[model samples]
Target: MRTAGLALAGFLAAAPAWAEFTTGDALVIGNARYGETVTAFGPDAVQAVARALRLRGQEVEQLANGGAVAMQQALDGFVAAIDEGETPLIVVLSGQFASVDGGPVLRPAGRETSKAAGLSLAAVLEVLAQSPRRAFLVLGEAGEATALEALEIPEGVTVIRGPAAKVAEFAAREMAQPALPLEKSADWYGLALSGHASDGLAVLTHTEVRPPSEAEQAAARDRIALLDETAWQRAVESGAFQAYLDSYPQGLHAEAALQMRDGAPAISPAKAEASLALDATARREIQRSLTQLGHRTGGIDGIFGPGTRGAITAWQRQSGTDPTGYLDAAQVARLAKEAAQSPAPSAPRPRRASNAVSAQEAATWNMARGERGLRAYLGQYPNGAFAARARVKLSNMQRGSGQ
Candidate 1:
């Protein structure tokens, strides 16, 4: 059994009132058998880390002798779970770490010696970058300083990498206690590890976290207000939400921004009203056209309210129009023509063969079904050709529901 130090109790007592402990999830991977060579203590160290995490009230997933396929699946599932909320994440990796093409890659248990077979550290960072919460990554059997130096960890994430034995020793000692505040634990771990030689341990983070100054907090608030305004202005534009997420992945409006970016249409009521230059007949014509194009307009009332605007935006997006949810003379004519050509409601559309379905086509197909289908399509082809449009549709749907 792994001995947990008094770190947990100390953390609870010493941490600031705002820094209370919260439940989190941990992934502990240990591979003792990698082709021919085996780390004597790798498996033991992983168990120790898992025990420590569990003692601190974290949900733990432990994998022993995990191969490439298993590791990939585990990481994908973990990332997806974290993306659903602001859950804290802890990752403990023990095994061979190889440096390839001036970067670091973790080697899972397998006979593959080819560098291409290994998992790149950059790839791991990319998934973690999508997380909107704090993360701690502890690496064992990764003593290569050059590899650690070359890593570009994202902000809000911390990394500790070192020799298997020494890294495991430090983790065991720290976790043996009740619990220590994460920041304090990192500080303590850094100090303890630094006492060893460079070859023994290494620590790196994108930025050193500290309590924000009053001015900094005020600046952040101002930036958030600006972001909110921008989101309102470009709520229908996927690029706008993308830009917001790029700047503040975990911002206050992050969930809202994600909904917009994924395909939720957020038309400004004022903008919609001002842009409505068409007479009632034209508006009804557009609504009927949208209905023919398989979009719902909530009874075609000839008003450019949320329902009509949402339907127009969906149709416009599908038909490769500007998706402004406002129709000009030319666009109205084109829509009328397309509506005339479309099959009646009872007619069956041709279905593409499964193997022949392109990612974009799949996205469009799924989007027509509903939000669940759109989400499934995104899961299948997150970076597919029509992913942007699919996201837009989903965002619009969520926005329609007032999310």
Candidate 2:
């Protein structure tokens, strides 16, 4: 079967041309001269897009058919333009991209020599990392790569990579029309995009920031006041103003609630989660619930990091909540309940007899692993020596989790 094209995860956004409204900087390097053996990449296409950017008044630093030294000089110019202003920075390199011993490098024109002959993409990526908001790196693969290696792209920066000619074409077309988003355009070309570049990224964007009109400000105040009043009424009915204040710091009756609690510090969302005093075991249970519910919390490890935060955000987005990427006491409870209603991620692994771990040790380990993993072991070895260890482990777990 024939395939369309291979895509790594993530997306990229090209900036709008801005000789007038915005100032956008671009670094475009096209290296087509590899050797007689390699296929020539799109030198003409990248230059076309560079010309398009320049036409829109963007500071364009382009190196056409450049060698390693020339490519390095182009990178310096790109950075200098960025330091001059805070604007959208677009970098495009179309040529023989390959995975070398050190890292991902673009083989410059007139280079069939050592790995050092190629320009390091890692350095360019580092520069892009700084201006992440408007930073994007469009890598167009010129020739067929013998080995496809994953490039380590940082957060906030977008990346769109595919066959050199097609991507360069896409970039040229999209840059010409700033209104066309990348997601919609890439879909037609079978390209994949990631990061903030998703949901159709466009070139030459000027985000006009103006204060909300009188009507808009009034509407917002009305909404917040209504929420505050409702919370206040509920607090009065339940005589739990302290709890109400903990949940809403800016409620209408917040000052009254504060007086009721003798001016206790309001519990922030972060503080509330910390108040759970969750141990590793409790954390794993939370992760399990999230994973089981198909949020994919990376792994069932206890610590909550970016993966867990992302999972939480995903869950919130699905549920139409605030999507704050943080969990409070109530949100945790809701997640637990929802996960119970949902099916498991996968079936339990069947026990296998192996010399590496004895049955008793396995039973104890299973006890350590959550989700009633101890049933098989307990049903068989009710009074084994390992059973005693498992019981002690459970007690430690309960204490650690503050349960």
Candidate 3:
């Protein structure tokens, strides 16, 4: 299948300094020098987009045929630069986008194929979603509308997928004029491309495009109400706010949740001192490191629950340190360093057994009746003496039930 081209354009028109796109960040990428199938107009499209963005008083980062590392670095820098909520982030990608596992993947210049050297659309969206600013993504010469449609874009983000034939033409026009407003540019491009029988132009925004279902809206409201409960007023921890945000990212109180997360007030001096002695974030990091090293802490939720403390103690014992549940800064650092050096633990493989069922297995054999019980028994002892019998019975039962 042929890879499609894409361009992501973000606009923060609500900013006070927005004088027809006087300030914003633009990343223009063109990957034409691919070892495999390459878009001939990719480089030209990138240059054109860069020129247009520059004319709009936007700081443009133009990369032509840059490989994966360079692209990642540029994207990271762009994301970091979007510190201010008012600043817009625009990304113009003029490269081959291959569909892999029902998702879009960007093919870099040096890669033989997108599967071997492509960036996932999910990763790109994650980077864009990090920015608090409202983003507008514009795709040029892109296909796979299904993949794009499947994306769960954040609340303020917008997407515009342009027609494949008109992508190069639009870029060329922008290069020549450079003063056209983004909306006008999109409109003109859409109009020109509408004549094509295979035209696939769409204007997508989270608000104007994808609306939440009634169930989803109700859940969001419930989460917002939970956040507004009086229990959180006295002790507004980062985790509490994070939980709320996780549940209702685009909720009515999303802005407030962000503020509380970013600017959480200091606790009392005594409380502060106590917390400093046992920093939750630090403890969570330690727990993660321990879990990665095969010492299960139940989970890494930042809460130093009994499971976490026990894990910490076990880790301390293994490291030849005093088995203190609490981890000091130095101890945490040491644990982190050790964990980094150790190989990542893999999932446990199922144990192989003989065909003969054991005494314990025989004891549970009577309980193994009906669909659920038989399935549970088979799961526990797949290689048991009655395994074949169980399978035949299960299959017959399933077939009889029309399952």
Candidate 4:
């Protein structure tokens, strides 16, 4: 009974090893010459793939400027090199997508190469599908989406790419500013690469990740944190997002995650208006709105000047209410009503004491919030109504701070 059990366990252990193929080499084709035009973007992308794969212990055969004939030869060589019995096989291609009737073609080498022989994504996937070996296909430039859509990723093979525009733009930018030769710093575009690789063990690119560096990991972490749930699902489903959240659950996005789990309410656009203080932009917007309503709330510069408050008061008066000068929900409503009723009147001069009261209130509110540059705010609009209150709060803060 013990011998039989041991034999069964041994077979189970050997089963997975036999079921998968694991060869350690790579074929990087950046076929830029489609019947003889230099394709800089495709070649550049292929070089990037070659460098990345070489670092990962793969024997790399890089073919540049090869049109269709050259591409076929390389594919044949690749097949010959890998033992069908092994597990993982990686094939990366970067080139223009040629639409040939119904099928998509990867433009290959030579001036005379027919546009057709360049393998379609479907054709490539079909060839890869023959063996249960794990395969990785990267369609860098044109037809990326169409190819991904056309090819059914064999159960063991993985397919990864973004839209053609995104891939092309990224490849161009990466080539323009190639990472420092062989530098493993995190800034090597590792973050973006990690984001792309989140779905599975996949090709690394400048947009997906920096080559391999400390900053690369940091950038990757930050990028991962920023990924929305839908994007996260894509990565997780692909099986490539590394870095355990439990290891650094309280990392940069810790706050965002906590907020999400806490069921934080979605901030409405209307609420954004009320949350404003006397920031430059906020002041300008308020003044503009008030001026349009005929309240003439000061100059258009973002300072909440006395003119703005006076306008608020007039708006309040016109609407049958006491003018509190400061903008609030009620004030906005009154101003909107007056605007609807008649054409805007000329800008009015400030009322004595009313502007001062409003200023004081505004200052008090600022002090309550512990906003910096209160002195500057006061200096700009000294005659505000809440001057006394602002002064009191400022003194209290100074005292508490032991200043």
Query: Estimated TM-score per prediction?
Result: 0.40, 0.44, 0.38, 0.34
The local lDDT score (0 to 100) that residue 397 gets in candidate 4 is: 45
lDDT of 4 by residue, 208-277 (tens): 1213234324422322232222222222233212221221244333333334334457533222232332
C-alpha lDDT values of all predictions: 0.54, 0.60, 0.51, 0.45
lDDT digits (tens) for residues 158-183 of candidate 1: 66666666567766665334424444
Per-residue lDDT over 1-403 for candidate 3, one digit per residue giving the tens place of the 0 to 100 score: 0011112133653432211222456666666655534554455566566655544434455555555545665575455334334345666565566667746766666534545456566666665564433455555544444444455556445555665446656654542243334456667777221111122312211111112224334433332243332122212443355443432345434455566567657433223322444445665677778877887764554545445557878988988887866665577678899889888778342222222246888666556766787798888877554454456446545534446
lDDT of 2: 0.60
Q: For model 2, which pairs clash?
A: 10-193, 10-194, 11-193, 11-194, 15-203, 15-204, 16-203, 16-204, 182-201
Top model by lDDT, which number?
2
| Poorly placed runs, candidate 4 (over 4 Å) | 1-23, 34-45, 99-102, 109-113, 130-133, 143-148, 163-403
The deviation in Å at residue 202 for candidate 2 is 2.1
TM-score of 3: 0.38
TM-score for predicted model 1 compared with the true structure: 0.40
For all candidates, what are the clash counts?
24, 9, 6, 45
RMSD value for candidate 1: 20.5
Give the number of the best model, judged by TM-score. Answer: 2
- Candidate 2 lDDT over residue span 222-246, tens digit each: 3334334344444554555554553
